[model samples]
Target: MTAHVQQLHRVNNLCAGLEWVADCPNRLARKALLQLIGEEVGFVLEGVICASEQKIPGGRPPA
Candidate 1:
Protein backbone atom coordinates (compact mmCIF):
# COMPACT_ATOMS: atom_id res chain seq x y z
CA MET A 1 0.00 0.00 0.00
CA THR A 2 2.83 2.38 0.76
CA ALA A 3 4.30 1.77 -2.68
CA HIS A 4 0.94 2.34 -4.34
CA VAL A 5 0.59 5.69 -2.57
CA GLN A 6 4.11 6.62 -3.58
CA GLN A 7 3.38 5.80 -7.19
CA LEU A 8 0.32 8.03 -7.18
CA HIS A 9 2.34 10.82 -5.59
CA ARG A 10 4.98 10.56 -8.30
CA VAL A 11 2.36 10.66 -11.02
CA ASN A 12 0.85 13.77 -9.45
CA ASN A 13 4.24 15.45 -9.42
CA LEU A 14 4.74 14.50 -13.04
CA CYS A 15 1.48 16.18 -14.00
CA ALA A 16 2.47 19.33 -12.12
CA GLY A 17 5.75 19.44 -14.03
CA LEU A 18 3.97 18.89 -17.32
CA GLU A 19 1.68 21.82 -16.55
CA TRP A 20 4.69 24.06 -16.04
CA VAL A 21 6.23 22.99 -19.33
CA ALA A 22 3.10 23.81 -21.27
CA ASP A 23 4.18 27.45 -21.52
CA CYS A 24 7.63 26.72 -22.92
CA PRO A 25 8.71 29.17 -25.64
CA ASN A 26 10.74 26.70 -27.64
CA ARG A 27 8.37 25.09 -30.11
CA LEU A 28 10.26 21.80 -30.51
CA ALA A 29 10.77 21.39 -26.78
CA ARG A 30 7.13 22.11 -26.10
CA LYS A 31 6.01 19.60 -28.67
CA ALA A 32 8.29 16.88 -27.26
CA LEU A 33 7.27 17.54 -23.68
CA LEU A 34 3.58 17.42 -24.53
CA GLN A 35 4.02 14.16 -26.42
CA LEU A 36 5.86 12.58 -23.53
CA ILE A 37 3.22 13.71 -21.07
CA GLY A 38 0.49 12.31 -23.25
CA GLU A 39 2.17 8.89 -23.49
CA GLU A 40 2.84 8.71 -19.77
CA VAL A 41 -0.70 9.76 -18.83
CA GLY A 42 -2.14 7.23 -21.26
CA PHE A 43 -0.03 4.46 -19.76
CA VAL A 44 -1.12 5.34 -16.24
CA LEU A 45 -4.77 5.52 -17.27
CA GLU A 46 -4.55 2.12 -18.98
CA GLY A 47 -3.30 0.54 -15.78
CA VAL A 48 -6.04 2.23 -13.75
CA ILE A 49 -8.72 1.06 -16.17
CA CYS A 50 -7.41 -2.50 -16.07
CA ALA A 51 -7.34 -2.51 -12.26
CA SER A 52 -10.92 -1.22 -12.12
CA GLU A 53 -12.03 -4.00 -14.43
CA GLN A 54 -11.10 -6.72 -11.95
CA LYS A 55 -14.04 -8.87 -10.73
CA ILE A 56 -14.82 -9.77 -7.11
CA PRO A 57 -16.30 -13.18 -7.96
CA GLY A 58 -19.57 -12.83 -6.02
CA GLY A 59 -21.99 -14.60 -8.37
CA ARG A 60 -22.33 -18.36 -8.67
CA PRO A 61 -21.40 -20.17 -11.86
CA PRO A 62 -24.08 -20.43 -14.55
CA ALA A 63 -25.57 -23.92 -14.99
Candidate 2:
Protein backbone atom coordinates (compact mmCIF):
# COMPACT_ATOMS: atom_id res chain seq x y z
CA MET A 1 0.00 0.00 0.00
CA THR A 2 2.76 2.39 0.84
CA ALA A 3 4.51 1.74 -2.45
CA HIS A 4 1.28 2.11 -4.38
CA VAL A 5 0.47 5.36 -2.63
CA GLN A 6 3.94 6.71 -3.29
CA GLN A 7 3.78 5.88 -6.97
CA LEU A 8 0.39 7.56 -7.23
CA HIS A 9 1.74 10.62 -5.49
CA ARG A 10 4.55 10.83 -8.02
CA VAL A 11 2.10 10.51 -10.88
CA ASN A 12 -0.07 13.22 -9.37
CA ASN A 13 2.89 15.55 -9.06
CA LEU A 14 3.88 14.95 -12.67
CA CYS A 15 0.35 15.75 -13.80
CA ALA A 16 0.36 18.97 -11.81
CA GLY A 17 3.65 20.00 -13.36
CA LEU A 18 2.37 19.19 -16.82
CA GLU A 19 -0.72 21.30 -16.23
CA TRP A 20 1.38 24.23 -15.11
CA VAL A 21 3.64 23.98 -18.14
CA ALA A 22 0.67 23.68 -20.49
CA ASP A 23 -0.94 26.79 -19.02
CA CYS A 24 2.15 28.84 -19.69
CA PRO A 25 2.24 30.49 -23.14
CA ASN A 26 5.22 29.44 -25.28
CA ARG A 27 6.63 27.25 -22.57
CA LEU A 28 7.08 24.45 -25.07
CA ALA A 29 6.83 23.97 -28.77
CA ARG A 30 3.86 21.95 -30.06
CA LYS A 31 5.99 18.90 -30.78
CA ALA A 32 7.77 19.15 -27.46
CA LEU A 33 4.49 19.44 -25.61
CA LEU A 34 3.14 16.34 -27.33
CA GLN A 35 6.29 14.43 -26.51
CA LEU A 36 6.15 15.48 -22.90
CA ILE A 37 2.53 14.47 -22.65
CA GLY A 38 3.31 11.07 -24.12
CA GLU A 39 6.12 10.54 -21.68
CA GLU A 40 3.92 11.55 -18.75
CA VAL A 41 1.24 9.17 -19.94
CA GLY A 42 3.82 6.40 -19.89
CA PHE A 43 4.75 7.29 -16.33
CA VAL A 44 1.11 7.23 -15.27
CA LEU A 45 0.66 3.83 -16.89
CA GLU A 46 3.75 2.53 -15.14
CA GLY A 47 2.37 3.71 -11.81
CA VAL A 48 -0.88 1.91 -12.45
CA ILE A 49 0.98 -1.28 -13.35
CA CYS A 50 3.12 -1.05 -10.25
CA ALA A 51 0.09 -0.49 -8.04
CA SER A 52 -1.73 -3.45 -9.53
CA GLU A 53 1.25 -5.74 -8.99
CA GLN A 54 1.58 -4.87 -5.32
CA LYS A 55 0.57 -7.62 -2.87
CA ILE A 56 -2.18 -6.76 -0.46
CA PRO A 57 -1.88 -7.54 3.23
CA GLY A 58 -3.10 -10.94 4.46
CA GLY A 59 -3.08 -12.29 0.88
CA ARG A 60 -6.26 -10.39 0.10
CA PRO A 61 -6.95 -8.90 -3.31
CA PRO A 62 -7.06 -5.17 -3.75
CA ALA A 63 -10.38 -3.49 -3.00
lDDT of each: 0.70, 0.68
Whole-model lDDT for model 1 versus the true structure? Answer: 0.70
Scanning candidate 1 in windows of ten residues, the lowest lDDT window is: 54-63
RMSD of each candidate relative to the true structure:
5.4, 5.1
* Best-matching candidate per lDDT: 1
Candidate 1 local lDDT, 3-60, one digit each (tens): 4456567678779988688889998999999889878877776555454444336533
* Residue pairs with clashing backbones, model 2: none
Off by over 4 Å in 2: 27-34, 54-63
Scanning candidate 2 in windows of ten residues, the lowest lDDT window is 54-63
